[model samples]
Target chain A: MTIKELANQLNMSTTTVSRVLTGQEKKYRISEKTAQRVKDLAKAHQFAPNQIARNLRLQKTNTIGLIIPDISNPFFANLARTIEVALRKRDKMVLLCDTKDETTIEEESITLLLGRKVDGLLVAPVGEKWAHLEKTNNIPMVLIDRYFEHKEIPYITTDNYAGSYDATSFLISQGHHRIACIQGLVHTSANKNRIKGFQKALADHKVDTAQTFILGNDYSVENGYESAKSLLQAAEVPTAIFALNNQIAIGVMKAINEAGLHIPENISLLSFDEQPYFELLSPPLSSIKQPMEEIGIAAVETLFELLENKKVTSSRLKPTLIPRASVKSIVKS
Target chain B: MTIKELANQLNMSTTTVSRVLTGQEKKYRISEKTAQRVKDLAKAHQFAPNQIARNLRLQKTNTIGLIIPDISNPFFANLARTIEVALRKRDKMVLLCDTKDETTIEEESITLLLGRKVDGLLVAPVGEKWAHLEKTNNIPMVLIDRYFEHKEIPYITTDNYAGSYDATSFLISQGHHRIACIQGLVHTSANKNRIKGFQKALADHKVDTAQTFILGNDYSVENGYESAKSLLQAAEVPTAIFALNNQIAIGVMKAINEAGLHIPENISLLSFDEQPYFELLSPPLSSIKQPMEEIGIAAVETLFELLENKKVTSSRLKPTLIPRASVKSIVKS
Candidate 1:
């Protein structure tokens, strides 16, 4: 039943009924008897204001839009889950849009979310372009994981440069000068920063530049496999390999298996992202573990600050190096 | 810009401007010149109908609410991804609600979705009771993965009984007389059906019921680990073990590792869900692979059918048994 029907049945104006139902009886100076009659009738008819209509009147849906590149990736999935939990605490719901790592779809998702009149947005953008994201119709948005260079959007992500540099330094400390880094999505800021850090670390350690190499163009197991296959066929293979992400690490492992090799025995391996099952593998993988939960929580906090019209800037959480069985030390003790 | 402001600038009535913008100019007999002028001005001002208002007028949001108990679970994550991709093809958007496997959260999520006036709902329900689900406010809803018995709600799920039976029978055929099953969530239909299948398989083979055991209360790695640890401590140990899900399988592997045992060498393992990394494990795991993608697509299809006022029934797809090195053949070849 609608408010109109309830009001008519109660012999009261729609305005009076709405005021009473919305808890404005005192403000409207409605008589106790009249308010009681309206309430009793509404209860009998099981009438409640249509949420959509109510939202329209208040101009607030209390919903936040969340856009991510891929949901199957455990890193992003965990991030999404954490963000949802945090938002639920704030009494907000997430309207999720998975772009499948396509820029066109990202643009479409932005439009769809904006059309829904979401209170704010949390996006992990795809592609190099930020034009679509720029036109958020003044709706506050916080980018997570990936961001554009010089964009005004506030993002919370891992310190990719520091993570890569530390991971590479550790490999160098193990007396492995020749290390191959398999990277993902060359255009992404995360990849760029990681590659930069890897190169800088090698330079700082006085490693022969000619012996090191960077390969692969996307974050996928297929890319890792193909790259590792080619690298293994080379006469002078790298002593160690650094995979940019967990998916790439899996591919590298598959290629290593196919080539009749064992991790840390044939060559050392260091991955960027840490997965829960990493320890379950034959040789537990050493990894640069990003503060994923922290990033998610901070992103939500930043978005809420923006929602409150507060000045917010980007944040980069540090990544920790977890040494396991995958990376072997070759230095003589 | 508001339509009223745009109309004032063009010295035209809101109705005329709205008609031209909404492509009803010809029907309203607005002159071609006036329509072109209005369009030009609106384009200059970047004006478009507020989507929220437009949706309200049309009484359609073209949005579907997806409520899953857990997003961190790869099984559900994959399901949600496939469903989202399928819905995107139909030009529909998904609003995801993660219930965290709590019934109260599930109820709140349902109320939240209903408030948004979603066109339909797809849920992997938490808890056994369906009293809240019985009332969808006339919105089309389809259950996925889990369902309630004797409920009119349509659902798409794996044939838990057949999958469990096949897995258990495989162990029996391997000449393993004693086997332990680590189950998840006793009340869920999937868990109940799987338990029933395990018992039926043992009965058909005439294995001593006293030798087999069923343990675990949740589909978590902790449950799998604790159960395996206690079972290993027992004087009589099962020759083989079956894990109810991927998460549980990971835990079992951990327990076996802690016990200083090796897969197949000490005890054989067969798991329920298939994961990409399963093949990469030391002794690749054997598993019952459900048609997860098919289940997701079928759920969306069922929901759309319901939206079209078609009769729908529950569907159970068969699961495939993927044999790998984890399950040892105790019988002489």
Candidate 2:
């Protein structure tokens, strides 16, 4: 039933009925008894306002567009779930656009979301470019997980540098003079910061630069597999391997298994981002767990702040190093 | 720039310019030269049609509402990714509402989507009741993965009964007579049909019903863990455990690990719905792999057919049983 018909049947003005139904009774100074009476009748008639028509009149869709690199990736999937729940609590629905980690798709998704007139956007961009995103006409956007260095857009992300540095230090302390790092998407700030952290940790420990190696250009299992396979077959393999993400770590494990190598004994391994299955894996994988829930909550909070015209600043939360049985100690006392 | 502004600058009618811009040049019999001229100027000026205004005018939003029980679950996450890609190719964006496996949220999401006037809906219903969905006023919708048996809504899902039956038969063949089936959401058709298959397989094999058991009422790791823990501490533990879904299987594994029991040696384990990490598990779990990609593609096709007023029927695709190290050959001469 339409709200107008319900208002007529209740013997009340349409504005008074709308104010009561929309929870604006206090703002409009409507009497509590009158508001309750209108609500009771509206409920009895099962009346619902036409949100699309109302949204058009108000020029606000009350929807947020979420653009992520890969929805199938457990890290992003978990993050997306958290973000969705967080936004849903505030009565905002999400339009999910998975970019498949491609720059062109990311650009297209941004245009599509903007064209839908979403109240805000939360993006985990694929590439280093943000030119297409820059012309959003101030639609209250917030970058999540991935962002550009010089971009003015606010973002919430994990402290990748600290996470990586600690991970490298953990491996180094195990007496691993030679370590190989598998990186993802070379130009991304997350990847760059992780690489910096890995290198700095090695440098701080006075490890030889020539002994460490960095490889791969994409955040994928295949990239990790190929890099690990090549390294395993080399004349001298690194004593340990550090994967920048969980997908890469899975690939590294597959390669290790195929080569008849076991974790810790044959080669120690470490990965960024803890997965639910990590603990269930053989010997359990040692990982730097990203604070996905925190990131999700903070991103929504930042976006809502922007929607409210409040000044929002980018923030990064620390990641924790979860040491499992995957890493081996090579020191001989 | 607006279409009118672009039309005036090109010295052409707004309708002609719009027809070309919206990829309707062939339908409107607009010349190729005129289409090229219109596109060239539109691209140079970076002009985009306001989709919201245009959608309102046509009463078609080109958006589909997708309501799934869980997005963090790999099965649903992978399915969502595939559906999004398939629909995006048809120029449709998905408005995702993750129900978190709640019936109330499912109802609320349906109302929200209908309020926005989405072109179609694809839902993985959380519960058996579909009374709220019955009054959609002729909006196109296709249930995916989960649905009610008595509901008129069309759906595309995996053959759950066949998958469960085959898994049970495989276990029986391996000399596992005492088996326990851990179920998920007792009221769901998917779980009910799977239970039927498990019982039928045991009956065919002449395994005593009292020896075999069905436990758990939710699709969660905690349920699996609790059920397995109780069974493990019981007077007679089952020779093997059948987990209804991947989440339950993970929980079962956790309980087994905590009890210091090994897979296939102390007790065998089998799970419905294959996961990427299943093969990477300690003993590499044996599982029935659902055709998630096929189901996603079919659901979209069915929704689009409904959108075009074409006759559609609910169809079930077959699942494959993958045997790995978790299930051992206990057959004795």
Candidate 3:
């Protein structure tokens, strides 16, 4: 039954009936017995207290908004899962807004989130454009996995530059000079930092930058496979390859196998991020494993810090290197 | 500023002020000049119409609910992503309730969904006991992946029995007399059908049912690894193994590798569900692959069907087997 019908049945005004049902009549001098009766009838009828009505009375929605680039990606999916778990622990629900990497969709999602009146926001902004987001609302926001163009906002991300440099240097130390690199989207901060790291490794080893080879493309297994195929087909293929991500590495391995080449024998391989089945493959793959769980936990911690104290906070966690059999030393010709 | 302040500033009634702000008064005798003034004042003050208030007036939340066993699993994660994408296309939103494989949580999540007045529900029940869900609400619901104890409701799933039978028979044709099966949780209809199919294959081949072995566990990579470890340590290991899912198959391979046994030489392996990275491994994995995208699209279609007609419908899609390098013919001693 609707609130008006319930109010007529209880011989009370509609406003009084709504206030009682939403548990806001404690200060209204409504008798305890009357309030309890209204509650019992509402429960028996399976009546849902209108959230909008409750919000009108309380001036708060008690909901948080989350906007992420992609949910199909395992890393983002896991991050979303952890954030949901953490928020639930605090008795807050989340409204998830997936942008799918489209700027127009991202802006629309932000507007919708604002319209919903979420108490705060947890965003992983797409691309380098932050002006639209910065001007949207004064809602409390904590960015994760990527930084904002404006440094005023708090964000948490892994050290991509150092991680890439260390991964490349490890391969060089294994006596590999002719190395090929598979990179992600060029303009993204994460991809740019990774390229910088790869270059720094070559410079530190006194290897000519011109001798180092790089291929930039989208972050997909198919792209990785295509790039690796061309690299392997080169007149003088590199002795080792550094694939920027797990999916790319997997693709590269597929292309290599299709061409009758083997890992660490015909060509060595290294990648960022580790998958569950990485060790099961022939010649276990070595990788720069990002601290996923740690990052998830840390993002929540930063969000909570912002929630508790109305201040900005930022953090960047270091990545760890995992050595396996994917890389082999280059033998002199 | 409140609507009352805007009305006072414009020297109009609060109802007129709200009508202009909502664009409803033009047809109700309000002048365009007055409406523009109201709109300008509202915009200058960054005034947001209370959605909670509007929802209270309309008595609808405009949200859908999704209940899944585990969001962390890749299969379920992909399903959630598909549902989210579909909902976004229609300008509808979703509230995800992750059950984490607990029946109590499943029941609680349903209650929470009902409390929120979700327009419809998409659920993948955790176990055999789903009476609580059946009793919770009469809302439109479309079951996915798993079926209920009673078959009155609608669902969408892959043909597990047919896929399993074909995979097992293929192994038998390869001259394997002793075949071991690793099964998922027994409570699920998918697991039960898979086991039935595996046994049927052996019976059709005139093999002694008592000679074939079965190991039941959850469909997890770690469990697959542990089961494989135990099977390998046995006095006489099976010449062929069929893992019910990809995660278990991956674990089985790791266990075999750790035991210093070679695939196709020591033991041949086959599994259900294909992962993209599976072919990139040392020896490409052979699997019965489900049409994931089809299942996702079908789930949405089924949900809409239930929403429109309130009629129960169940659809099953067939699976295809992909032959790779993991399986080998058995040689008799």
* lDDT score for residue B197 of model 3: 87
- For each candidate, the DockQ is 0.68, 0.68, 0.48
> Candidate order by DockQ, highest to lowest?
2, 1, 3
lDDT of each: 0.90, 0.92, 0.80
State the lDDT of candidate 1 residue by residue for B197-289, as single tens digits.
999999999999999999998988899999999999999989999999999999999999889999989999999999988888878899999
B32-121: candidate 3 lDDT, tens digit per residue: 788888888898987876565666667666677888776667777777888888878866677777777677878877776676667788
What interface RMSD does each of the candidate structures achieve?
A: 1.4, 1.3, 2.4
lDDT of 2 by residue, B127-206 (tens): 66788888787899999987888778999999999999999999999999989999999988899989999999998999
Q: How many clashes does the backbone of model 2 have? A: 0
lDDT of model 2 at residue B137? Answer: 72
What TM-score against the true fold does each predicted structure earn?
0.95, 0.93, 0.89
Clashing pairs in 3: A52-B52
List the candidate numbers ranked by lDDT, top first.
2, 1, 3
How do the residues A265-298 of candidate 2 rate in per-residue lDDT, one tens digit apiece? Answer: 9899999999877888987999999999999999
Chain A of candidate 1: what's the TM-score?
0.94
